[model samples]
Target: MSYVLGIDIGTYESKGVLVDRNGKLVAQSAVPHKLEIPHRGWAEHDAEATWWHDFKQLSKSLIHMARMNYGISADEIEAVGVSSIAPAVLPIDRDGTPLRKAILYGVDTRAEREIAALNEAIGEERVFEIGGQSLSSQAAGPKMKWIKHHEPEVYEKTYKFLCGSGYLVYKLTGQCVIDRYTAVNYAPLFDIHTLEWNDESVSHMTEADKLPALTWSTDIVGTVTRQAAEQTGLAPGTRVIAGTADAMSEAISIGAIHQGDLMMMYGSSTFFILTTDRIMKTKELWPNVHIVPGANTLTGGTATAGSLTRWFVDQCLGRDMGSGEASNWSVQQAYTYMSEQAGLSPPGSNGLITLPFFSGERTPVHDASAKGMMFGLSLNHTTADMYRSLLEGISFSIRHNLDVMQELGASVKRIVSVGGGVKNELWLQSVSDICQVRQAIPEITVGAAYGNAYICGMALGWHDNLEEIDEWVNIIRHIEPGVNDREVYERHYAIYHRLYERTKDLMKDL
Candidate 1:
């Protein structure tokens, strides 16, 4: 039986899935990783060890699992699809090897100076006109400028600048390409309307040729070469699709294809994707082309979500993260304990509130200097109240983004929740209560890895159109808002908005 394999490299863990033509998941695997903070407000990943290494291990293991348990052979795997965190900056030499550890996405705030300089040089209004969003640390192009200014040797030796998915495509098929949806995050350098890179945007310092060739997310970029086949255990000549960012893949996994479909992806960050009919731009949000041709989407996200929870658990719960695999169960136990305690806390966390900007805020505010704050902390409070307050803080942030979407004339007909956070009953239900919108949880909440597998099915012609996703998506449960708790959260939501502005300067002075 022919199979299509998909893998996604995420913030905390990497997941891979193997699926047959009928859209059934056959085998799956996961690898947990820790974020590397080499400096204050900077995040980096060893490209070869974290990204490529995880892919190699997961691909081989999934292939073996399929062969042994499902009676499927490696040769039967017909196509491969990949997705990863985007707006990443990785400079590579002529041979496509990473020159240094890759500078990660929005969470990495090392490019603040470059972002300011670019906004001043290009004019924020003109940038929004061309790219549909104002420049922020999230854009990869300015991070490119960061290297040229600081790491000149690395810049001189660089040949191509590739993000996660594009780099994977290169390793697999020797084809270097990035999908339009992901490439759009390289703002100022890429023209959203025309879908091409330009030198004029960066004052000609950036060479347009160094950027990967653009392709649609589902397009088959190339077939696997023998070298990649040997390394990955995928069959030689297997079709490899030019995939997209993990958030986009998460959007596709939940059937957020048509206009007005919104996906609330709760991973390391809280991301929202609202599909629209025409281009939409806002200083508070991001705009990009949808995976489908001619469609558009507006996106907003927070830099902290699951990552923030993990930080609290590791710091206060004594997980011994440095002790490795044996300590993982302890960390899991701590999470369960926290969730149970959080459930006991009353709505609004007994008058507690956290800003949820541990890693600076993204979307709407875009304030890098913002710091996390927790108010109403008293000796009488317990860890349970604090944990619940953090969860509510994240929910309030999501509501803020949804409100922005509404102000932009986008109405949400449905909200699909996916990612690691879906299993948290409180987080899902709290968002519903705070936002007053029901959320549907799909049967398979395997996150973006499953979405990448679905993309592979589409690329292989197993599904003529995205409507076929209906077969794979079956809502297991509906999380509805509690009417009685609405007033309490309604008041809290207003305060959540005000607390940020009141604390903005205080946070900056820190």
Candidate 2:
């Protein structure tokens, strides 16, 4: 029997899965890592260690697991697929090694100055006309401009700029290529109408040749090279497909592949991907080209989602626990206590409100200088209340983003929830109640790997049909808005929405 290997590089962790031709998972493994905050507004990743290193180890372990546990051989692996945080910028040298830390998507606000300069120079209207989205930290063109202007030395030596998926694909196949869906993120540099790199108008930051060749997500870019096989234990010449962003892969994981289907990925960040019939441009939301050639999607994401909760658990609660094993135990105990406490607390978090802009806000507000806030905290408030407030606050942001998408003429027939954060039922319920949108929770919430594996299956002759993927996914139940919590959140959401506006001036000063 043939099997496909799918791996995804996430914000805090990376996961790999081996799936049989029947869509049954044979082996799975994950590696956890940290996101580096070097400065107040900057976030980054050591692309080699966090991305490529995790990939090699994850691949090796998955191969061993498949062989010992599932009785599958390396040659039996048909094709490999990968997905990662996107719209990221990592400049590479001629040898394809990263020149410096890769600038992360949306959360990395170091490029704000670059974003403003681009807007001032090119005009926002022209950028939106070509890129389908306004220039922002999430747009790759500005980030590359930041590199060129700030680190002229690095830009001069750069051979190509690659995203996470492209980096891994190159390591495996040695072919420099990026999917069209991600290519759009480099807006103004990429013309959406033609799906090609625009050199005539926008070529100041870097030459068009420095970018990877654009390809469809499902297409096989190249086969694994001899060097990659020795390090990862995969057979030589194994086909590798051009992978797309994690959110798009997650949408496929839960069968939310049709137009009007919305995917909310509750991972390191709360991301929304809405499938559309055609491209609809808006400054508030990112209008994306779909993995499927003729389709389109509206995409948006908050800078922090699970990462906010994670910080509270690790930095705040786990502080006293010290290092090593004690720290992990402390985090677990803190989460356990908080989860129970949140369950007992009333829906509105005891009249408390929090603005979930810990890593700066994205979509709707799109404020890079936004700061987190906790209003109405009293001495009587418990740790549980604070944690619950965090969830509620994040849900408010989710609603804010969804409102923008709907206002901009995108229809949402269904919402599919994916990623690690969905495991938190309280957070799920809070998002549903606050957003007033029902969410379909799939059986396998770890959606990206399966989605990636399916793409690998496409690389081989084993999968021409996506309908087969539907069978692997089962939407167990829907999280409907609670009648009791709805009105309570409504009263709070109005204030939550205004929190940013009221604080924007002060936030910028910070």
Candidate 3:
């Protein structure tokens, strides 16, 4: 029997899945990894150690599991699909050796100075016109320029600059190519109109030739090489597709392909991708070509969601993350206790409001120096109230992005929720209640890895068209907004906005 393999490298963990040709899961594996934070605003991963090593480990484990349990051999897997936390800037030498650790997505704000320089050199309006989005920390182009200015020697020896997925594709197939949807993050260096590399505005950073070739997310780029096969226990000729960002794959996994279909991925950060028939060009939201041909998407994201919740648990609950000490409870048990405590608190948390900008804000606000704040704190408040308010704060951030998209003439007909965050019922309920929108959770929410497998099916001609995704995906549950607390939330949301506006300057100064 024929099968396919899919893997995704995420912020805190990596997951892989082995599935039959008909979308039946046969085996899966996951491994956790550390996120290196050397400086306050800098986030990084050793591309060779973290990314490539995780890929090898996950691939071998999945392959072994499939072989032992399902009687599947290495050659039986027809194709491999991959996705990763993307728009990361990883520079490599001529022989595909990583020069330095990769600078991660929008969460890493070390390129603010480069962003400002680029905006001044090439007017912001011109950049928007050429790239279909404004310069921000999310833009990989500025991060590339930052490397050139700060690490001149490494930049000089750089042969190709690749994203996370592109780096893995190279390790497997010896081909460097990035999907169009992922390339949008390289704004001003990638022309949204031409759908190709454009170095006119970013020649000071690097030339277009230094970038990977662009391809559709499902297009077959090359075959796994003998070296990779030996390392990962796969057939040498296994097909590899041009993969996309983890968020895009996560969106596709839930069959969010139609216009007005919005996918909210609650991972380390919360990402929103609203599929559209036409490009929605706005500086507040990113406009990009969708994985589906002839379609587009307006994407926005929050800098913190799951990460913020994890932080609260680690810092406030007396849970020592370094030593894995949580009194007598496991990490999962601690989270369960936290969620139950949060649920006991009222919707408004008795007048507490939190700003979830611990890693600085992304989307609409676009403030890299933004700081996390908890307002209305008094002796009357308890730990439960604080946790509840933190959840509401994250909900408010989601609502803020949705409101911005609505004001820009975008409609949200359906909201499909995915990711590890979906397991938190309190957080999901808070989001729906705050946004006043319904959310649908899919049955097989294996996330980006599942989407990668389906993309591999398309690449191998096992799936006919995009609409066939419906046969594999089904909505299992729905969360409708609660109306009783609307007024209370409305009042708190106003305070949430006003507090930020009033204290943003102080946050920057401090």
Candidate 4:
């Protein structure tokens, strides 16, 4: 039987999977990593140490598992597909050595100043016309310009600018390439109409030569080299496709490729991708090209979700309870305990509401200076209330994005939910109640790694098109919205909006 390998580099971890053409997962593995926050608003990762290092580890481990557990050889793996937290800004030298730590996705708001400058220099509407999106922290062009303005020494020596997935592809295949879906986030630098890098916009940021070659998400760029093969334990000359962003892969993992298919990826952050037939230009959300050609999607994200929960554990619960064994419980066990605690709390968090902008606000608000808040806090409230409120806060943010998408005339025929968040029953049900949408949870929630494997299948012509993913994915269950909790959530959601509008200025001042 033939097999393919898929790997994804997430914010806090990386996962890899090996699968047969029938979509049976042969082997799977994961590795944990840290998301560095060096400054107040800066988030980064060492490209060589974290991304490439983790990829090699996961590859070797998964390949070994396929051989030992499933009797599959390395030669059986036909193609490799990769995805990562994307639209990141990673500068590399001519020899493909990372010059500095990679600037992460919208979670890092260090480019706020650059965003304002670009919007001022080129009118916001003009930019929207050019790029089909607004100038926000999510835009890679602003972050690229940030390096040029703040780190001129690093910028001057840069050979090519790459995203997380592109960097991994370069390490494996010695080529610098990005998918159109991922490249669309490189606003102004990439023209949505032409579907290529714009030479005109290069003047505002780095040189034109610094841009990576663009291709479709499943397009095979090259094959694994001998050096990369030795490090990764894969056979030499294995085809490597130009992988796209993780959320895109996650969306495809569950067969959310058609128009009006909304994918809510609840991982380190919560990202929403609404696939559409044509581009919908809105300042509130990002217009992205679909991995499949001649299609578009509107993307939105919160700066924090599961990461905020981690913060709560680290800050509220002490160090021993946060990282180490709390009553001899593993970290996952600790979270399960916390979830049980949260279940004890009533909905609306018993009059407590949280704004999950610990990093910043994305989507409709797009406020970099936005701060996290817990309104209606009282001495009577317990840890359960606080935890539940955090989950509710993220759900409110999801509703806010869905409202924006609906206002833009986008339809939502189906909602395919993926990521670690699906495991939390309280969180999943709360999102359903708060968002008033049913979520289709796939049986195999291994996420982007599985999606990567299928994309590899496509690259190898095992499937005719995106629709074949339906054969691979099966909906195990569905979470329908709760009618009883709607009114209470509606009232709290109002307060959630007002709380932000009222205190945003104070947050900026601080």
Clashing pairs in 2: none
Model 2 TM-score on a 0 to 1 scale? 0.97
Error of 3 at 50 (Å): 1.2
CA deviation > 4 Å runs, candidate 3: 318-328
Determine the backbone clash count of candidate 3. 0
Off by over 4 Å in 2: 320-334, 465-468
Better of 1 and 2 by TM-score: 1
Q: For candidate 2, write residues 300-401 as lDDT tens digits.
A: 999888888877776655553311235556544665666778888799999999998887888878888899999999998887888899999999999999
Report model 3's TM-score to 2 decimal places: 0.98
Models, CA RMSD each = 1.5, 1.7, 1.4, 1.2
TM-score of each: 0.97, 0.97, 0.98, 0.98
Q: Write the per-residue lDDT of candidate 1 for residues 217-293, one digit (tens) a residue.
A: 89999999999999999889999999999999998888877678898999999988888888887888998897768
The superposed Cα distance between candidate 2 and the true structure at residue 28, in angstroms, equals: 0.6
TM-score: which is higher, 2 or 4? Answer: 4
What lDDT would each prediction earn against the true structure?
0.86, 0.86, 0.91, 0.91
Write the residue-wise lDDT of candidate 4 on 1-510 in tens digits: 999999999998899999999999999999888899999999999999999999999999999998898788889899999999987999999999999999999899999989888888877887888899887778899999999999999999999999999999999999999999999899978998999888777678889889999999889999999999999999999999999999999999988887789999989999988888888888899988888787788899998998998788766666545444444656677788889999999998899999999998888899989999999989999999999999999999999999988898999999999999999999999999999999999999999999999999999999989889999999999999999988999999999999999999999999
TM-score: the better of candidates 1 and 4: 4
Candidate 2 yields a Cα-based lDDT of 0.86
User: CA shift at 339, candidate 2, in angstroms?
Assistant: 1.6
